[model samples]
Target: MRIHVKLYATLRRYQPDLPRGAALLLAVPPGTTVNQVLQQLAIPDNVPLVTMVNSSVCRLDCVLAEGDTLNLFPPVAGG
Candidate 1:
């Protein structure tokens, strides 16, 4: 299966070669979960991240599907 990944804010550093806001098309096996994708991308487990699947907030255990869009964002802080 294949899916699109978009990294926002500091999470973009995980894929430095990709242009900001570009969707990284990734080919993954069936039953791949958000946590697995995070590991595959070398994102640290301690990094506080917000995950979204197809625009809906989801947990790391969420299973991915072909053509699903996964958006990763770093923690947002404001005054």
Candidate 2:
């Protein structure tokens, strides 16, 4: 299966070489969960994340489907 992933804010460091706003095209096995992809990307478990699948909020355990778009964002803090 294949998916498109976009990293935002601090999470963008995970894939720095990609052009801004460009999706990281990934080839994953069928039934792969969001958590597995995070692990593969070496994103530390301690880092908080806001996950979205195809533009809707999703949990880390969400099962991904072919052509799904997964966007990852780190929580924002403001004064």
Candidate 3:
């Protein structure tokens, strides 16, 4: 299956060495969860992150769908 993944802020650093853009079209197997995608991208799940799918906010356990757009953002913090 293929899905679009977008990384923002610090999370963009998690993207693999490739063309820079608003998102990346990733090829993942069926049943690929957000957590699995994080691992595959070398992004630690333990790290604070905000994940969304198709415009709706979701958790790491969220199941992705073919052609879905997944966006990942690093949690914002301030002093």
TM-score of each: 0.97, 0.95, 0.86
lDDT measured at residue 5 in model 1 versus the true structure, 0 to 100: 95
Residue lDDT tens for model 3, 56-75: 99988989999999988877
Identify the runs in model 3 with alpha carbons over 4 angstroms from their true place: 16-20
What is the descending TM-score order? 1, 2, 3
Per candidate, the number of residue pairs that clash is: 0, 0, 0
For candidate 2, the 10 contiguous residues with the lowest summed lDDT are 70-79
Error of 2 at 39 (Å): 0.6
> Which tens-of-lDDT digit does each residue in 29-77 have in candidate 2?
9999999999988999999999999999999999999999999998888
- Report each candidate's C-alpha RMSD, comma-separated, in the order given: 0.6, 0.8, 1.7
Angstrom error at residue 60, model 2: 0.5
Model 3's TM-score against the true structure: 0.86
Ranking by lDDT: 1, 2, 3
What candidate 2 gets wrong by more than 4 Å, as runs, is none
Candidate 2 lDDT (Cα, 0 to 1): 0.95
> Best candidate per lDDT, number?
1
